[model samples]
Target: MMTQNLLVELLVEELPPKSLKQLGDSFARLLAASLEMQGLMSKDAPVTAFATPRRLAVHIGNVAAQAADKAVTQKLMPVKVGLDAQGQATPPLLKKLASLGADASVVPQLKRALDGKTETLFWDSIATGISLTDGVQKALQEAITQLPIPKVMTYQLADGWQSVNFVRPVHALAALHGADIVSVNILGLQAGRETQGHRFAAKINPIVLHNADSYAQQLSTEGAVIAGFAERRAEITRQLTSAAAQEQLTLIDDDALLDEVTALVEHPNVLVGTFGAAFLQVPQECLILTMKANQKYFPLLDAQGKLANKFLLVSNIRPIDSAQVIAGNERVVRSRLADAKFFFDQDRKKTLASRVPELNRVVYHNKLGTLGERSKRVLTIAKAIGLELGGEALANQADQAANLAKADLLTEMVGEFPELQGIMGNYYARHDGFSEPIAQAIEDHYKPRFAGDALPRNPVGVCVALADKLETLVGLFGIQQMPTGDKDPFALRRHALGVIRILIEKELRLSLDMLLKQAKDAFAAQLIKENDFIFDLKIFIFDRLDSISREQGYRPQEIEAVLSFLPPYLIQVPRRLEAVRAFSDLPEAASLAAAYKRIHNILEKDMKKGPMPGVGSVRNLFIDIHFLMEPAEILLFNALNTIKPQADEAFEAGQYTQSLQLLAALKEPVDAFFDSVMVYTDDANLRANRLNLLTLLRDAMNRVADLSKLAVN
Candidate 1:
């Protein structure tokens, strides 16, 4: 069958801007997958997705007009059931054949084969291929059904009697193969070649697509619309850059903002607008956020990376005289900036300390008590961490910062923009004459709000950040509201990862178990019902750490070897993993790892068999060189005596790599012992001595990491 490019489009009311890209991509992928599964298109066929505020579309190349016929072999009932003992077709077999559009006349053509232990009857037939009309209809319906729509709207169709649910009200449907209409109907609209374009700027009221391949070109030329989401986004980026260049400023690079703006307009015209200089006095984050979030404008920054007075707005209509558009945008932005300024000025009237009492009214979580209580807990944790990290002076600063961190929740600025909670607290802290370190800590406590985000700037900030995350994690876990699957409404995974990042990246010597204990201690005993949650919480944190380590390029075995030891301080994990990786590369590494694994197995088997005669208990076993009868055991014992101290000294000095490297000298002795010596000998003293020696060797070799974990079976 010959193939031609195919196009499908759904024109509707404005779609949710944030979801348009996903919706378009999913529609194309699902539709193409369905077609390919139906044999109507190759899996490698090229697919293009187009999405705008008013449309979602896809164009797939090399799609067939009809799927190829398939030869199918379907299993029937067992021969004993299908054929009577006399070899005549039974009533059940006749009924089964009838269901498959066959009858007794065709029963003789059935084949018998062994299925498991029973001889089963099979029917061979050719399944007819689906026509383009049926295939396209099914694929389109499947695409729409599987679309990742954020929400669905129920609306009446043109007939007013029938209703349909969609992301938005569908006004038109367009689909074509080459130059011919595909004749598929959806949402009470038949597929056609016409689709509406830009609401106000289209040269034609209804854009007439010429063919499957001409959809994008015609839409761009006549419809005054950039149909492809990425193409439109790129065009807007280019324009923003050019506009920003003319003013000698740089555009704030926010991909999310760009995508939202792209979806808002089919015909993007980037125009620069100026705000009053008075507005620049407000924090740039506040003003920039208002412009990007409230008005979908791009804020420009000066050479020093400070927000400038001028910003760029993407207008849907491109007017010949652009002064009015710029002025209209500027007027709207000035009003927004004025509101921000008023909030900022009003929020500054009260110190963060004064606003602290109001947080008592705001609930953090019903089970976790009010934000005020949470703040008190965080302060306790922060103070403890600070003392551990930097003594009394830093503890004072962290305590003060944590006390006032959530105060901004009551501020006018934060009330209007929750994203400004920590930010406004910082401003208020400084305004209240607090020290710079304290003010910075208030803001930086929420540092690393996302992946790859920067950590808190100073020691005070680190203490508070760690405290705040720990409080949230321990409190929620205490209340039995722990995150399940992907439903982390409180962002516990992020909090755990935040803790992991701070501990590992900041090289904090704080113990993970100690921190969890500190957090749990801050909460009242009666309020925390999960008595054993610390163990579960520790496991959760380690799981997140394992994921982070893997993402950072550590191999699974290397990670397991280090993490299996459950090193008290997370700060030691990276170095330990590094040591394990380095140790694995040594020539003796394989033999040593294998021998360590063998030693482990021998010790485990002996321990399971209960205490030996000479060894009172495996746990209390000690090496006795006097019991070393075999030369191999004696030689290994000598090797251990010599190397153990050196490795121990290096490990104590935190020279993990060097320590693991020192163990490389044991490979030959270990191999010889395993080959020539029997750990479980007939002589009880020899067996006890061997097991004790292996236990000592295992302990010494695993100070940095479990070497047996690296062993390959």
Candidate 2:
């Protein structure tokens, strides 16, 4: 019944820096989960995860040496099937008892219980507890099997014959309970109290962890390593900050870069290194990217938010004199910077317009033609959108920008760093003597590339960006290459979200239906046959919109009500949602919503039943004042006449909240009409008139959103 803290470690070759944190966390989480599920530990036990370049470890608090025995009851079979006329054991009962390690001798002690509709025999027994040795073995194996390894490596063990698959070759396994070693094995390594650390910088060759609680302290002092991932990352941050402060330069903040660098070193030593200032002559984006991506260095920026000549490198070893480390890093970065400068210089020799023809040779998609054909389609869509947004002047600018947007894909710099495709195009377009708007548009056309990214800055950029996204969506959907589940190869979801953000956030007055139509028309020359793709594309975009709305904290019913109308101007959607939300708060909202539901159901039923004998056609039925005999029907008709104009005026003037609020005045008459008047009265004329009156009320109420959707019942 004794409990103590436990420590588990896996020593191996360097892990993948990008996924080290995930692997460590998963290993700790899965191990602790298995122990708790086996009743060997409480669910609330404290757990700590440690990850370095060479190891993954976890410490769990209050883990038991063995799980407590549990009493269990199990259903056997129906009493009729298990018993005979003489009230004795049957063959089926005896066989079931044997499978459970029991025999007919214990049948007299069995109990009977009602299960569902039948009386069944039940067996009760005490299940033996599992010892720590068996429990830890099972837990360790479960953790290893469920690890999210990015890539698996197959290597031979020490025997030179048996092989194992792992993220890296495992050299040692350590597991401790208090001061005692736990008997467990994985990847052909037996558990022990000793683990290797900081291959070169460790104060001791092999760290002998004294106990579960001493693992971290011993690794830090004797092993010369900071075993915890977060602690080491913080230390690196502290050093970087102090160093940058001394130089009066700000550290460029990139969490992903920081995590990767943290995973690349066990004993992180932050050192300052610099490249030649002349490299800054190239675009800062190109220089910064090369340093971060190729060199895994953090570039410092000056007060003006410009890249400085200095950069920071995280080294795994600390030496008395750091000059050698700094110089080596500087030498390596200079070569990378030189390559970037070369590409930038060579890319400028040819104009972006000159490179346009080369895109024909670059395959975009085999089914969708080359980048050249795609660019033409984009240019057409952009120009049309521009004309609609800003007349001929904007259209010409959009045309010029869209035509050169993809040209940079053929440039040397972009070829080396595809992340800089639109970026390099801006520089090339300016060097080609194009106007600032055109150049800027060429760059901004790929704006808002990811979630929460900025949108295009100017009208021309907006036109081009929308056109570019639309072409991708329509063309791909046309090819039936729509994204299914998590596999969005072309990132259609991102593109769709970009379009929705641009339209809604920018408050552009463009029509969604018109934009989709224009995008589809651009592909006409490609001779691509069309199906329900336009409709499907709309649904796709709307689905993205629904997700965005939900993230913005709108209720599902509220979103459904507004989207059900399929408003053409996406700019108006937020306003419509606001109106619906405001209307729901009104005291009359519930009654009116319920009345609308009733009215909708009545109209639906009548339409489905076809026309009455003397009713002419129900579809075209209109309320005639003479047909309004009942006072409730007359009162409702009079209310519509009085309220419709005011609501229509407010709606036309874009006062959506005011428009929906105006309908609140009709709740009394709507309730009275529904309570008194029978929509399907025996009198044919009266029934048709009442239905028409309800239909008119429905139209007025739904100008903002479908109120019936808000009906709770």
Candidate 3:
């Protein structure tokens, strides 16, 4: 029953900064899960993962020296196959027993159980537990093999002849159970108690870890390395904040940049450095991106959220005199800033409007033609959308915006930093003395470049954004490159969702199907003449809408019921869902939903039996009160007639919830009719009349949603 904590470390050259966190997490989980599966550790055992630039390590508590022995019952074969008619052991049974390290003497002790129509013979035995060393080695191998490494490198070991494949060159492997070394080998390295630390600042060359539990503490003290990735990140954050406060500036918060920097260094020393203030004349986005992406520095911002000339740097080594480190960083950043400033100055010399002709040379996709052609298609779609949303003035603005949106692609600044595509367009457009709306539209056309990002700020921007996204989606789909199961290389799924988000969130009065048609029309010259693909593309958009609806917290039934109608206006979906939800909360909701379902089933079954002799449509027959023998039938007809007008009025007035509530009055009459009336009477006319009444009931109930899809309970 004795247990001991274990520690494992894989020391290598610096790992991929972007993948370090994922690598460390996967290594710890895979090792722990493998141990638990082998019964060498409890399922709830505590584990801590450590990841530095040079090492990946994990400490697990309460790992057993060996797993517990387990009783196992394995079915050998069917009873008839294992034994003769006399129920005695056959030659086959003897062979199986021998293979299991047993003999005929144990045959009578076999257990019998039913398995798929025949009784089977089973052998029961005690499986010896795996020793900790063997289990740990297996787990370690699995953990290493299963790491989510972005890329692996093949390099020769110290022996020079043999090469190993790993995320980085393997220099050391350490595995410990309490204070004892757990002998194992991985990536051609033997298990040990020593690991290298910070390349320059380590107090000792090979920091000797005393025990499994002392690994992190010893590394921080003797190795001069903060082993825990999260701990080191927090320390960096603290230092960055303190440094920023001293300079009366704010550090731009970017989790991705922070994480990459955290993975880049072991012992973080935050230092403030400054670039020439003249670089601020260029857009702050360009400067900030260069600092974060190229230099891996956190750019500080002034009180107005403008980029300050100064930035904070995370240094790997802390020194008594930090001036040299600060100056070196500043000097390097000055050069980067100078390059950015040059790009900006050169780009402003030519207006974005003048760059439009150059887009003709830039190919967007082999099948989709050049960026110029794509821009033309977008301009057409944008103008049409604007004309629909507004009038001639809006259409003109949208057309101009779409025409110039891709102009920034040819600019020096945008060519260097593609992330600033739309932003650079806005700046250059303004520099050309273009009106604010047109400049803003040029930028806002790509407003929602990501999920939850802002939508276009004006009508012109909205039109252009829709056009841009629709162009991508329909063009790709038209060429039969539809997205399938996460392989959307062209980002068709994002384009679809972007379109949906704009339509629903902007409350634009645009038909999704029509938009797809327009997009397809724009690509008519290049697109294959496919008839059914347009509908498929619409379904793709609807799927994204369904995802959005679910994310908004509506019940699946509510979403299904509303979407079943395929409401012509997607902007009205939220209102329809709201109405359905409100109606579902009514006291009479369950009965009505059930009755609506029952009526639909009855009508469908009647149609299957063939329509009545003279009736054009069974669902459209007129209700005859003379055929209604029961008082309940007459009462329900009167209730339907009474509530239909009120509901219709409220529905027309855009009072969706009100319309649904008005239908509640039919519940009592409906329940009574179903209970008392014999809908399927022998007389054809009587049956037809009943069907007509139920059809009316179905239609009235479905105005807000297909109530039948709602849960009756």
Candidate 4:
């Protein structure tokens, strides 16, 4: 047994750093799928893939020394069917072609049939193996054609090429198996055993990859690049902290800024830089924004505990004149911060409350309405949430916060930084002499910004977030802008997820339907032209809640089954989910599943088509002691009767699986009843009583889930 490795690299002039990660992942998946099809990747081998902005690298470990030669079944019709029994090939199929659509060819044929009947026949093809070189070449060609790239171009001799076209100019292609270069053509570039490295940090000369094994370090040295974003980020962080320690200052790691910075550079060079000490007079946001947004640098607070006027930068270049690069970046940031300070001083001249009406001057959405109009709707909804929480102070605070939430949108600072929409509102509100909670709630309104982001920390802020999300969902859904699969343009999915996280994480007990109705009522005046019915209105929002339920780990069927006759209790679904998970751990569960499976099978087979037999309310004969003729029958009846009301009581107390377990305890008696007695006895009343008991068993089983849908394993 021999092991082999394969490595590929595309040495291009400065590939976009932002697009590399996704492109690298796609290239790996495409190569793996194609190689497996060609039998180059063995069942025992594992494939590894890594990337830098300038290059994509792959290594296949324990790969077969040579690809297993290719083979596949090729079906060919027999002469009788091929020729339509006229010794002439069938016209339609004969016109058809191979998998890649080449002209069809005839080969060996045979025929077989069942029990003396006429059988259609085919050429049962057992394809003979082809050379290993040919197999790997075909896979390479297929994989290269399918690799996803945002921008591709082709610059080689274009006209005569019979291969796939691409977006980028093909300069050079490298591919190696162990130490040998694989022979193939990608676009116009030939595959060979060489790769390129860091555009600035490494040798000006390209690295010759003797084999796939030597790919990683060679390219990193050449490009001065890091293989993973996470690694690169961590290195920058450590260096920045060390540099900050020199002056007794610290780097504030802004995650949002880091993500953008990560996408912008490959090989990061960290350096400390300072702006004029006088520019420190600017508000902290101004200095931080100018440094973070414009220069892609991290800001620091000085030892005296003021805006330090010092910053840390990550550059793609390693400068011999580090001081000159630092001075050039600092000069650019100072100009921007000066403008921000001017805007801040000018904007604060007008009170946040007075700026409310100016929001009408800005368009929220051309079709939706003005920003001021949206603010009014948000305030209305927030008051309802405040009332639900039983905080009279919070309810009033929410209304004040909602009215001022978009006040910053009218400010120049927010206009320059769209992400600072609610942010500036909080700052300005505080200056306008609003209370601290109201001022803080202004910024907190945009909490749970993304999946991993924080939720609103204050009660007042939670109220505003609830109001803001409801307005968007209700307004957009009213106009039929609801998100379909993978197309949540309005981010209704995030908003719904925010709602669930708030309720669950905060441990808030509230009815989902009641909250949905509040959203529906917010749009009641707007829905007049659409319809008079409540059904059409609530379904859109309820549909969102159902989607939320599934993501919260409840099955849609379970949510719907429970919702059928019950109130819309968001809190109960999780409890029910917990109970279902707990029920699976019981020793009696398997026995219950088996018993239900047996009796359900009998009813399913015999009771549907002809006559439905059931045990009804007639207990008189069974009431007589002699009618309890069989001791086993008496015991089974007592057990089921005892558990029936117990299941109902458990359900009433919201102990769903406890209820199922109560019913599950009847499993033994159920098995015995079916084992000992015949249901269709000559005595009609006895038979009816037995059937009614079985009906009770079936009804109880329906409470937790449709038991048949569950597989025991």
Candidate 5:
């Protein structure tokens, strides 16, 4: 097998750094999928993806010289319903197959084993043999042209132009599979062996790629672009670290700023620049962000444990005067630091205590009324939740912090930087003479907005966190604005996940049913219409809970069955799942499942509807000696009575699975009862006795899980 290496490059203007990476990934995966689906064989290699401010590239190795030849299959019908009245091969079908380059053949038919019923079928097949070159070309075009480039624009306004447009004009399309050019006519552009070098440095014409590896080598020397992000990043980090070492300082390790810097340059050249000691008076965080965010430079701290009056910058080109690039970066960073210093100074003039009353004017959400209104609601909701959870300190702290949680939203520092929402609130709360715990809660309550974020750290913070999330969920449900499919505008999923973590991690003792209704009532007055839809709140809350629990090791179906009988759906789904798991371990558990499955299948197959009667409220089982006749029936009667008491004790002690196992011991008797004693017999007394037994069994089974509804899978 010849190793056919391939390279595809799309040369364009600078792309949005984030979107370009996603596009580069999609290009690699979609191309691979297209080839695999076409029955092409390629030794799977790590797809190397690269993106510059200007171009995106992908290289694949060990690609097959050609896709495997395809053998087509099609079902052909007989020309006559019963192979013609002459009982011979039909001439019409034979003619069609001959025209299609296929030899007509009789396919076999056999008698059904269930009964001696016979049938016959024939196939007159056709295949349009595709040349390897044509197939590869067609596949490549589909992969490139249909690549997901959202929010595309039109360019040149010319005929045969591409429907998809990117941030910059796609000036060149370079593609090569081995020594051959993978030619494609896309929109108005033509793909060939020719590619151009960097726009600024060494602009050359039509560099012909020899092969994938050689193509990458030629691009590095001539094309002037690094072909891999990892390689480029490595080079940048090495250069910056070594350069900083010479100055006796350590470079700040900011992965995020490193990524952004890497996207900005095709060729990175590390330069260390120095600033005046006068500017070092600025706070460390402010100076660091200013250097990275404003100037795209990595700041260095001196070994003396002081802010070094210096920063490291990665540039695309060596300046004619090296001193100019260094000086220019310093000036830009100084200006950004000045703005931060001004904001910091102004924020301190009025203590956070003075601004507390002004928070009433800020709007939290247009529909949820004002921030003041939200604060009041949070205060009430948190107090109630804290009390229910038996945390007096948490409830008191929540009441204090809820009043000042959003006070920072109105601050100049937070307004300019939205990411500082909770930080500023905490700072201001401390200035307002609040206790340390209360002040901390203001910051901790907004935690875990994203999957990677941290949770609130203290008991008080936890209550406030719940109050904040509950208000959002209950408020949205009230207004009939809910997340479905992929649409989660309010991030209700994150809110629910926060609540789940609090319950499991902190082990709170509050009931979900009571809390959910309290939240619903807290925001009930704000709802304009759909006043009657309050009953649907359980479904919405449970939907989020189901998703959260599954991630915590609870089976989704088990969660569903447990929630079916338990209202408010707030308890640990994993606990219910555990109960069901234990119940499944019983010897008779399988028989119980099988028996219930049989009962459910019969009812469903007959399309039975409406709730069937169960042994209503009879906690104890009766012998009914007059009705008992068969030995199995008499034995089952005694076995069920013995198991019921033991199972009940286990179930109440949270040994639900063990209870199920104990209940499952009756499978043989259960099977025998169904096999010998008829449930709906003509004997009215016998029927009543059997009905009572069934009711007892159903209730026992329901205690663990609704076994009848369990899917065997």
Candidate 6:
């Protein structure tokens, strides 16, 4: 029952900043998980992971010096094969016992049990626990092997001949159980208490950790390093905010940039720097990108969210005066900003319209044609969409935008920074004196490039956005390059979700199937007839929609009921799902859903058997009103006639909840009919009449959704 806290550290050269956080987290989790699995640590042990530029370490609480011994029962062969006919040990039994480190004297101690009809022999033994030294060594090796390292480096140890592969050249390894150093070795380094701190700011050159729990504190005081990833990140954030507030500006909020900066330095000192005001003439995005991407500096923003001339730099060392650091950062960033300004000025000389011809040389895909041909197809789809959404005005604007959406790919700025493709197009479009909506549409075509991203602001933008996404999806699927598992090289799934999000959020009255068909037809000249994958493409989009619905917190049954029909109007799906959820709360909801399921099963079975004498096919799903024989059946028919029109009226008026609730009155009559009437009567006329009545029941119940898919219990 005795336990102690444990510590492990791997000191090395500076790691890849982008992957440092992941490497540290994975190392700690994998080590702790292995120890817990082997019963060396308890389930609730506290684990703290630390990652600096030069080290990865973990402190685990309440780890046992040795795993407790466990009692295990082993099942052996059947009794007949293990023992002779005289109930004495046979040669096979003796050999089996010997292999288990047991002898013939202990054979009588084995127990007999039934395993599938034959009696089997079982042996019970105590498994000895593993010592802390052996356990920590095994865990340390596993943690190193399982790090999420982006790349590895091969380097020679001090011995000068033997080489080891790791994320960086390992300098030292430390392992401690309580205050005692545990014997362990990894990456050609033996375990010890010595670890290096910050490259320059540390008070001590080689900091020695005396105890497991003192790792973080000692590193901060003696080594001048904030070891915990989250802790270091918080400290950087606090410093940035304080520094920004003093300048009456705000730092751009980017978590990824913060994490990378935290991983790059041990002790953060936020220093304010400024660039030349002449760069303000360039687009704010261009200046901001050059500052952040080219130089690892945080751009400051004014009250209106415009990029300010000031930027913040996170320095690893704190000096008496930060003037040198600030000035050096400003000098480096001034060059980057000037280059951006030059690209912007040079790109504006040639408008987006004049760049259209250059798109022909740009290959979009090997199978799909160049950007010019692709833009033409998008123009065709966009025009049709715009005309459907609005009349002539929007159509012209969408066509203009679609023609120039990708023209900026030829621009010098876009060629240098591919992320600014659509953005540069918008600016160029405006410089050419195009209308505001058309200019905006050029940039907004890629509006929902990511999840939860905004959709196009205007109808023209929506038309072009929809067309662009559809073209990509259909073109890629046409060539049988559909995504499988986690390999979506072309990001078809993101495109599909973008399309779905726009249609649903913008309330665009567009048919998903119609858009898919338009996309397919746009590629008609390129698509071979046998390779058309339109149906599969639609399924893929619906799959994305299903995921979105689940994330919106709808019940599985509610989503299943609404999506089962695969309604043509995806924008109205959320309303229908909400209605289904409300209906499920009604007292009559369960009975009605059960009866609907029964009716569906009955009709499905009838169709599968064969077409009836009068019934032609599944499409001819109509009920004859002449065969209402029983009182229960007549009541149900009358109820359906009364409620169907009312529900239809509400549904057409967009009162989805009211339309679904109108069917609750049918539950009583439906239950009565099922109890008193026989749907599969021997008489042909009676059976046909009952089938038609059930069909009528089904049609009335499914006005808003397929109610049968609702959960009854």
How well does each candidate superpose onto the true structure, as a TM-score? 0.97, 0.96, 0.96, 0.75, 0.77, 0.96
Tens digits of per-residue lDDT, candidate 4, 155-220, equal 545566444455445567787878887776666678887665556676645678757876766656
In order, candidate lDDTs are 0.91, 0.91, 0.89, 0.69, 0.69, 0.89
lDDT per residue as tens, model 3, 1-713: 79999999999998999999999999999999999999999988999999988999999999999899999997899999999999899999999989988999988899999998899999999988999999989998898889888888999988899998999998999899999999999888999999887889998989888999999989989989999999999999999999999999988889999999999999999988888878899899999999987999999888999999899999998999999999999889999989999999998898887889899999998888899999999999999898999999999999999999999999888888999999989999999998888998999998688888998888889999999999988887777899878798888888888888888899988887788778888875635576688878888887888889999999999999998888878888899999989998999998889999999889888878976753324645577778777899999999999999899999988799999999999999999999999988887777788788888888888888889998555
lDDT of 6 by residue, 1-713 (tens): 79999999999899999999999999899999999988999989999899988998999999999999999898878999999889898898889889988898988889999999999999988888988999988898888888888887899989999999899998999898999999889878889998888888899979988988888999999999999999999999999999999999988999888989999999999888988888899999888888778887999999998888998999999999889888888888888888898999999998888889988988888788888989999999999899989988888888999999999999899988898978888888889998889988999999799887888888999999999999999888888899999999999999999998889889988998899888778875635355548888888988888899999999888898998888898999999989999999999998889989999889889888886665323446555666668899989988988998998899999889999999898999999999999988776667777787788778888878999898475
Off by over 4 Å in 2: 75-104, 112-121, 525-527, 613-621
Q: Which 10-residue window in model 2 sums to the lowest lDDT?
A: 613-622
Shift in Å, residue 437, candidate 2: 1.2
Pairs of residues clashing in candidate 2:
none
The clash tally of candidate 5 reads 6
| Model 1 root mean square deviation, Cα atoms | 1.7
RMSD of each candidate relative to the true structure? 1.7, 2.0, 2.1, 6.3, 6.7, 2.2
Give per-residue lDDT, candidate 3, residue 60.
97
The true-versus-predicted C-alpha distance at residue 467 of model 1, in Å, is 1.0
Clashing pairs in 3: none
Ranking by TM-score: 1, 2, 3, 6, 5, 4
Candidate 2: deviation at residue 85, Å? 8.2
Highest-scoring model, TM-score: 1
For residues 378-439, could you state the per-residue lDDT of candidate 1 as single tens digits? 99999999999999998998999999998988988888889987888888898899988898
Worst 10 residues of 6 by lDDT: 614-623
